[model samples]
Target: MYKKLAIMALCCLCFTDCSQASRSVSCQVITITDGDSLTCLLKNKKPLHVRLADIDAPEKNQPFGNKAKQFLAKLVYQKSVQLRILGNDPYQRTLAVVYNAQHENININMVKSGMAWAYTRYNRDPMYLNAQKQAMKARLGLWQDAHPIPPEQWRRKKRK
Candidate 1:
C-alpha cells in the first residue's frame, strides 16, 4: 500500500504545471493552426499551443502552404501524441519534438515528406539535414517548385 501511494503521488506531481520543464506529456491534437503550429489538450492541463521544433513550413498564403497544413492534419488531427517539451517559443508556444502513437518523429517526417524545411538556423541534426536533402533530391511536395520561397521570406515580403 505504501508503494502504491508513492506511485500515485509521483503521477500527480508529473501532471502539475511546475513539472512542465523538460517533461513529456500525452495530448490530443485539437487543432492544427498551420503546418508547424498546433493546439493540443494536455492531460489535466489547459490547451497547449505547440510549435514543431527544428522545422518551418510554408505560411498559409505561400506556395504549398495549404498542402502543408493538410499534410500535418492528416498525420495528427485528433490523434494522441507525445510531446517532448524543450522550451517555449517567443509566442509562448511550447517548442517540442512531437512523436505519434507509433513513435515516429513528426518533425523529421514533415521535412522528409517535403512539407516543411529543416529550419537550419536553429537545427543542425543530421537526421533533419538528411531528410531535407532527400526530399529535395526526390523533388517531393514543395520541392517540385523550382524556386519555392521560404515561409520566413514570404512573411517578410508580405510585410513590405
Candidate 2:
C-alpha cells in the first residue's frame, strides 16, 4: 500500500501542471460540464469543479464531443467518487485523478474507451499509454473516426 501511494504521488506530480498542492476529497458528482470536467458537491455542499487528469476529451463542439460527454455522464453522474486532487488549473477547476466507489480510475476508462486521448503533455504513466494504444488498435469509440481530431488541436483550429 505504501508503494502504491508513492507511485501514485509521483504520477500526480508528473501529470499535473497546477498552482496548488495535492490532496484527496470524496464527493458526489453533481454535473458533467464536458467529457473532461465535472462539478462535484463536497460533503459540506460546496461545489468543486474538476478536470480529469491524464486525458483530454473532445471539445463540446468537435466531432464525438457530445458522445464523449454522454459516456462520462453515464459512468459518473450522480455517483460518489473520490478524487486525488493534484492542483488547480488556470480555469480554477481542480485537476484530479477520479476513482469510482469500486476504485476504478475514471480517467483511464475514458482513454481505454477512446472517448479521450491521453494528455501526453503531462501524462507519463504506462497504463494510460498502453490503454490509448489498445484503444487505437481496436478502433474503439472515437478511434472509429477515420481521422479523429484531438481536442487540443481542434480547439486550436477553432481559435484561428
The candidate scoring highest on TM-score is: 2
lDDT of 2 by residue, 71-153 (tens): 99999999999999987666768899999999999999999999999999777899999999999999999999999998888
| C-alpha RMSD for every candidate | 8.0, 5.0
Tell me the TM-score of each prediction against the true structure: 0.86, 0.87
As for model 1, its CA RMSD to the true structure in angstroms is 8.0
Candidate 2's clash total is: 0
Show model 1 residue runs off by greater than 4 Å.
1-21
What is the overall TM-score of model 2 with all chains considered together?
A: 0.87
lDDT of 1 at 13: 45
| After superposition, candidate 2 runs with Cα above 4 Å error | 1-20
lDDT of 1: 0.88
The number of clashing residue pairs in each candidate reads 0, 0
